[model samples]
Target: MLRITATATISLTVGAILATAGFLWADRAFPPPLPARLEASTEVLDRDGLLLRAFATPQGRWRLRTDLASVDPKLIEMLITYEDKRFRQHRGVDAFAILRAGWQLVSNGRIVSGGSTVSMQLARLMEPRDARSLGAKFRQIFRALQLERRLTKDEILTRYLTLAPYGGNLEGVRAAALAYFGKEPKRLSVSETALLVALPQLPERRRPDRNVEGARAARDRVLNRMVSAGLLSEREAARAAAEAIPERRLALPAYAPHLAETALRNAPSATAHRLTISRPVQSGLEAVALNAATRLGPKLSVAMVMADARTGEILGSVGSADFFSTGRAGWIDMTRIVRSPGSTLKPFIYGLAMEQGLVAQETLVEDRPSDFSGYRPRNFDMRYQGDVSVRQALQMSLNVPAITLLDAVGPARLAARFRRAGVMPQLPPGESPGLAIGLGGVGLSLRDLVQLYTGLADGGRAHLLRDGTELIEPSTASTDVLEPQAAWQIADILSGVKPPHGATQRGIAYKTGTSYGYRDAWSIGFDGRHVLGVWVGRADGGAVAGLAGYVAAAPILFEAFARSGLALQPMRRPPAGAIRARRADLPVTLARFAPGADGLTAAPNAPSEPPPQIIFPPAGAHIDLAEGTAAPLAMKLQGGRAPFRWLANGKAIAGLHRTRTATWQPDGAGYSTLTVVDAAGRAASVSIFVE
Candidate 1:
């Protein structure tokens, strides 16, 4: 009988050994399930790892990446003390805690405390169970064992911290901390840490957004447990429990939304993307844009881009005034939209002219009524400054002189120069190069404008803007769009231009432009360190009356610089060949621009074009004057020739010269016949009675 029993025991032991070997072999042969913890929420962060934007995970939860190093260490201590006291010593499950729980259940005839370790909880979170049954518990045990064999203690703890539930759609400690305290998890108060440690246990029941009283109770429980475990003094626990609980969730940081979206799309496989944006600067500029757009008219939008000129890194980009407003079509990124740049390109024309030694700052240029072929360019105010210095003409943005210089430099060459600097201005389809391009005839986005201006800021060398990618070294080749001397000259000229009120002391070189028909307004400027561009107008191509760049956009530009938090570096010193001398000191060839020299007038002995016709206040019409003595009647003309002369009631208007529009002050209650005659003696007449 003894021999038979020994044989049976040996057989049973061998069978158990075989089963153990089979299980071990299976664990080695088959791969464990890929942890759901790996599917982290995609995030867009600033240069310092501060959240700029975050996207929901594929499961529609906020499961951000979290580890022990990033989390508050106090919270970790509280978590282990409350959840699993023997967590470090146990392999996967706490045998002592399980036995204690079973003993309490049997003695009390009901369940008391759960014995699952932190590892077991993580396993359940990774592979969720539909039912709370013995089968689910067994599955969790198996997963816990697998995790213990595959991961380190910190790894298991990090998975718990990241995957633990913290109320609706929030599945991580960092998300909980941010949602509750509106800050990061790296720094937390005792009360906040206690609440965070308790939420994952019964997240839905104690969600602060939905159940404030329950949340407070749960937090107090954590504090009490902490005191009992000797981790916290009773007085400290009581003080912590008295802290207020957040009743509402807070929104995550949403700066640089367009940039965040672009980065995410560019790197779709990445779980997180780090940008070069500065959070403080970005936030401040976003506020500036929002406030500016509100002050501007309805249906109008604002877009701004600011970059580091020295490194060519895009620091801040406000894609639009509002990203969620459908009324303004704010979802469209205006920074990338191509529209007429207006007079913004004028500086480049002067810069190119300077590079060719064709003009100096003090060179005399005629701003009188001029025409190149059929393209008659006039100043913005439709009046001439007549023979002003090049600096004055450029500062006042006189169109005639700019076009003349562009005529000398050739528009094709200017276009090619910009292309070489990584800015491609879009001309009208099938249109040949013309002098009108010097007067806002071509198309460009704010981004392109910033690129060109940054070149001037970088001493004539243009570097491509960095978009959170690898840094590209600037080239020192002759491929620079402008020579150092020319760039310094342009920068100096712009720095002398007047700033908007309340911003006169800012040492920035800025230029403003109003597109034809008031469709687009632009303000582009740069200091020694940074380049900024602003655009304001309707999203759809429609004219907004009284929309001029200086009035609509320049204010925002100045305000952006003031709020950008970057110290304005002084512009570089003038390079060789950059002179600030008077007109007489310039070379004779560059001192004075002759009439026909720039193709701005009819060739000598050429046939004269017809004189202009007065189109407004038609002949024999009676008119009642509007209120206000300053309200001069607007006189318009058509088919004008060079230097068209205007006469109201046979008196030549003093400031009237070659242009389409002329404002004439009417004598009170009189008959008036307005006649405009060209320099070539071609004339037309309009008569009206003023009441």
Candidate 2:
């Protein structure tokens, strides 16, 4: 009777407990309450709507972003297949995936599979920019749910593919495609597509440059998965596995470093939409920098910037070594930093002074040593040339007179003008003293200096480079910033500026600058279309020193200008009205001409006989020929014994050996003038246009 009574009670208790448990289980819910709303930092792009770069904050670095449509599809497929096979079917986190993950946790020794959906991963990647935490993970999941509700599966896929990091500073598939195959993602072959897919799994380790074999193996493994998933055929998978991948990407920068330097600053502005930086011009500039650096050898580094004066578009820029060289980390954009501008700053000060009526074009100024508040400035040679006119001082970059002009203009106002012109530099309390400002001891970016010069070229008006294509809307700057007449006068001076007698006939309007102790060498010159700023020195970086300070660096500047298509705009030429011809002016006195005539290598002591006459294409040349077609525009003269010499583009012709006839051959795609100097030193000239 007692045992029956105890068993009945126990059974009753068990039944009651079971009923309560069932009710509790039915009432319980998953994924508790929601948290507060979260916001993400938005990335800004170039005028073309291309992402310029992103940073954690203002203090952080400007990180470059790769384009979308650049990544391989295989990578996208791999993540979806491995982590969430039913991602397309689920709203956000699949219930089945979660259930499977639970089973995996119990059955497997490690958390091998994640139930987290693609949307969840993207949410985390975009926000907090932080490491994984339980709370953070939950927040990510919540955002994923919101995203799933907001966007379609296709949109989610597109967003994920575009924003995902594939490795090597690449932000999207489009960038990966360009980096790996130098092509667009749509053009990727199955094998190449598979390789890019594998990189994101372990970016640092699988970087193609580091572990080509490992990346390939990972790619093959992913291909197996893709094939099994029926995205690609088994035959396709096999072919991809067997194929060799080209493991290289040319870091072809879309904007020249200088252009980037100029445009990036104004990205936050409303006008950030009109700037148009040309891709090919930028590539050519980069190519020049790289080739120059390589040809000079690794010990020397080069930074070059080329730009259009009218539009303010930087065509090419390079900060570090050439892209073709190995082991270069392009973290530092060389075209931005404001090095001591050297003599490069002189022209602007001269122009400003000229504009302010502080000095006129031909006003006599002293190039000899001068003092300001006990601070005296010396030329690069640390010596002085006696009294020089205002034009000569600027043309020769005469240091003492520049200081005198700066003293006259007052550094504070000039500094203000510099700021207005977009030059970013620390100006000494203008009230203090020195000629260093004129000498470019004032640090300013390459872009700022270029802009300053462009304004001078454009008739003393400054314009900011807005971000996009609306170039016609350049914000107007100070009017008459430079007097048109004075600026013209400076231009004339520079055209004829050089050494003892005259300047080189290249006729480029240029300025050579050297900072204190020769730490920097810069040459700023212009043709009608563009103004080129050439800075030569170290990139891994060091002060411009020794030979690099002078001979080595100066030639590079002149060479680049010569090679580029800068024309020496004719300054209001000297009136031929003041001159008359002497009957004897044709003879011995021809060689007795005054200094400053560019490219006048020789003059006849006297014509022993009738001079040579050009046989082909005549003087004002305009003709076309396929490359390497030799057309020696010959000359026939009475005296054959005179050594035949020729000049092309103001330099000596490569192959000339006394023969009376001179060949006017086309070298590159351009026009050149030929100067004929005979054995008797008699000279004649001709111009040829060749295509």
Candidate 3:
């Protein structure tokens, strides 16, 4: 009897070894057809990892990649407790759960619960099957064992989270949370966690958006299970069950659509693209752009961009007011489309002049009807402010003055400066930079103009703007657009200009431009840290009558700054040698801008006379005025023809005097420019400071 019992034990052990060997051979011969790779939707995330935009997979499914850490801990705990209590201990299938299910089925004459572990569910998700019979269950068990051996516990969990269906084309917890709750899964309330945990079972039937009652019931079941498992208290379970389920799914985040598309094109194979955008700022600016476009007209589109001046990082960009609107041709990215830039290029012209020491803020410059080699340039109003100060010309955006300065500085030089800053203005096929280039004659994109303005904001240093598409690290290399002092001077003048009507003053340096025929309107503004550019126009290049930049785009620019949710960074302090001196305080040669030989045309057969020269209040002189009183300074000049026009800082004295000597009341000055223009148009000037 002992020998027979020993023989039976040996036979059982041999059978057990043979069964294990067979199982291993089957596993290797028919390895579960696990996918080599999972396809996930492409996502564009902001700097803080907030979703900015997401593109659907080729199969039209929303399968966002899921990370275990990004999901709420409560959801995981509740899911494990309700779905598979022995999930951690089991390799693939839970023996105790299978036995309990079998006993319940036999006693109740029906299947009461599933014996499948989380690993089994993940296997089924990876390789779907239509059959619900014993054969399908065996297949799932086999595949689950293979997955367990090949992947870690966390890896299996994450794959399950990523592939689990949640109604419609939404696959994965991240997509489900974003659709139902309009937020990420990183932070969810107890009620939200319960809903997400229960959705994978009968996803379509329990979808909250389709059947709120069914979803609520499923969520309540999850909460109850959590309580039974001691994962949650009864009171907590009840509170969670009482919460309302979302009746409608919200749309996913879709900000910066144009920029998102650009990123996708630049990196076609990347599953996730991270950008420097701030979601809140992008949302606010987009709203502002849409509202402005709607108010302007049905055919007009609006575009905007806001960036860090020092770093050149784009914080927000709106390619169009509405990406789906047909009337405005919203599909076009207006920010990158080349269009006439109007007077937006004027600031750079003046900046170059200042850097070259050709003009000062108070330098008198003629703004009359003029012809540059038969190419006549006129102000927007078809009227001119004769003999205006350089500061007034720029603040008023006078076309004649800008052209005159551009001519003196040479349009080619201005274009070179723009190119140095990584912006190339589009010109006519055969035309070089001409006087018209100063007044909307050249084509440029809104982005190009903003890049140029960054120099002014960052003390003459211009950085290359980026939206994170480049593989290399952000570069600190910058191009010099102007000297520090010259840039500061431009910023100071722009900051002093009044804001558009009905807009609050923001203390930002801004310039506005109107293209010829009123086809385009532009406004660019900046503080010390950030720069924002706005463009308003018909996408078809049709003119919108009376659509001037100040009236159309400036208001929107101001509104964008206000809505951007960022505090207005103060303008930088003036650099060394950067001082705002009155016209009279300028050097004798700089007191009045004398155009080059090419810019000036001598009067026909006019008598030549010695140029007028200031005698009293000599150049760079300082005089003390009586306190609390309007004190007049005696000014005198010699030579030149008379019926002389005495001017202080470009404004004519009350009346023309035949006598050279004249008395003028100082405008409570710190610095002043006194000038006299002779009958022959010859002029002399002096700068003085009055205490």
Candidate 4:
């Protein structure tokens, strides 16, 4: 009998050893397929780390990247207490819990509570199983043991937090929180914690949007379990249970849609992109664009961009009034679309001329009908201000004067300057730069125009605009767009332009432009620190009747500045050698802009009478007129036919006089123009500032 018992014991021990070796070999050979690398939605964030937009995962799941540090501690505690009581102490499986579950199942003749630890649940999530048989349970146990051996307690928990489902197409705690509570999972109330902890058990069935009562019951059960486990007090649990569950999921944040898309395209492999945009500024500008577009009637779209002149960082960029609107072709990014930029290019033309010492702010330039070779530019009003100071012509956006300057400066030189500023205006193929370019003949985007103006705002150094996503680092390299004095002169003239009707003047120096046929309307402005550009038109390049830049875009520009949530920075003080002088104060050559020999000249064969020339308070002079008192200014002229008519700023100062001198009372303390025209049509003008 002893020999028989010994043989049985030896056989049993041998069998047990073989069984253990087989289990170990199977666990190693068929290890659970842990996700090689979890995929999460890519996010586009603003400078402040706020979400601008998010793209779904390849599987079309809203699985936001999450970690233990970003989750609420209370939610973690409640989750462990409710899902797996022995979660902290267990290596993979809880033997005592398993035994208790078995005993309860046997006694009750049905399944009781689950004995799976959090690690086991994580293993099951990694390698999902459809069957609930003994074999699947044993496989889960083996996978759980493998996971505990390879991962730490925190790693296991974090993976579970990320992979656990909360509802249809929503995975991970961050996504769940954003959808249900409309916020991040960084802070959660007792009610919110309970709801999040309970959703993972049966996400689909307990989805609050589909079955509110079921979700509420599950949440209450979690609260009760937490109370029993000492994680929450009875009163706190009762209060949490009384809270209502969200009946529907909320949409995630979506801002700067066009910019976000551009960022993604620039960095297709990056999981998160950070741009130099301000969320508040973007939000405000978007609202302004939408409301403006709605009021402007159908098919009209608006695009805007605001940037920091000092750093070239794009603060706000609105591609269209609405990205989803079908009528406006909203998906097109109008800020980058090349279109005819009307009088917008005039400032740059004038700037180049001033830099070359061709004209001064007060110098006279003829705005009468004149042919530039073959191109004859006309005023927007189709009328002429025959003889006007350079300042008056620019402020009025007169085309004739601008074309004359362009002709003298040479169109190719102007195009070269644009290239230096990193903007290349599109000219017709095989065609060289022409005088017509001065009057919206070249193609440029709103962004191109804004970039050029950045030089005017930042003392002649044009900063390269960036929205992050460039492979190369931001360059500190400065491109000279204009001389400091010239830029300052341009800014001064633009600032004096009156704001559009009903728009408040915010001390911004701005220029307005209207493309030929009224196809595009543009307004670009700058303060001491910021520059903003606005475009209004149809995306298809179709003309819109009555679309004058001053009437259509100037108001929007002012409104954008007001709603941009930025303080109005004052313009910079004039640089050295930059001064506003009357024509009398200017040099004899610069006293009047003579478009050179290549430009407009006296009619061929017309007998010449010496032109009327202002001689007193000579061009660019400053006179002291007593303040708050009527003080007459003494003016004189020479070499003109008798019966000369005098004018001040386009208004008649006195009737034709044979005498070369006259006196006129000043109206205000500022710059004024004095002109004398002879009976033979010869004219001479001087610019004077009254103190």
Using all chains and alpha carbons, the TM-scores for the candidates as numbered come to 0.80, 0.48, 0.85, 0.79
lDDT of each: 0.82, 0.57, 0.86, 0.85
lDDT of 3 by residue, 6-110 (tens): 999999999999987887898899887666568899999998988899999999999998888999887887888888888889899999999999999999999
Per-residue CA lDDT of model 4 for 1-691, tens digit only, reads 9999999999999999998898779878987777756788999999998778889999999888778998998888888888887888988999988898899999999987888888888888888889788888887888898898788888888889999999999998988998999888887889988999999888999999999999999999999999888988999999998899999999887889998898889889999999999988998899999999999978999999999998888999999999999999999999999999999989988887776556778889988989866877889999999889989999999999999989877899999999998899898899999999998999999888888889999887798888886777778577979766678889999999999999878999999999999999999999999999999999998999999889989999999999999999999887643578777655444566765454422323333567668889877688886666665777888786777767654345545578888888766665566666565544565656667
Please, what are the lDDT tens digits per residue for candidate 1 over residues 498-554? 987666569999999999999999999999989999999999978999999989999
Q: How badly does each model clash, as a count of residue pairs?
A: 1, 26, 6, 9
Worst 10 residues of 3 by lDDT: 598-607
Q: On residues 1-691, what C-alpha lDDT tens digit does candidate 2 reach at each position? A: 9999999999999999997676346334333222332122234344354433233324332123332344455555665775567888887777777778779979996776677788886676566445656788667766777677667886677666655666656655666666677766767788877776666556677777667887787788878888888888888789888987667655533444434444445554432333354455444555566666666556565666666666666544556555334433344555667677777777767765544323445445657666565887777667888866666677767788777767655666677777776665665565342456777768776667667766655545555543243324556444334444345545555656552222245655666676665555666666555666766655444553462323444455555555544444543332211112232332221323111122122343544566555555567667677566666545343342356655443344556566666555454554444455555554554545556
Native-referenced Cα lDDT, model 1: 0.82
Top candidate by lDDT:
3
By TM-score, highest first, what's the ranking?
3, 1, 4, 2
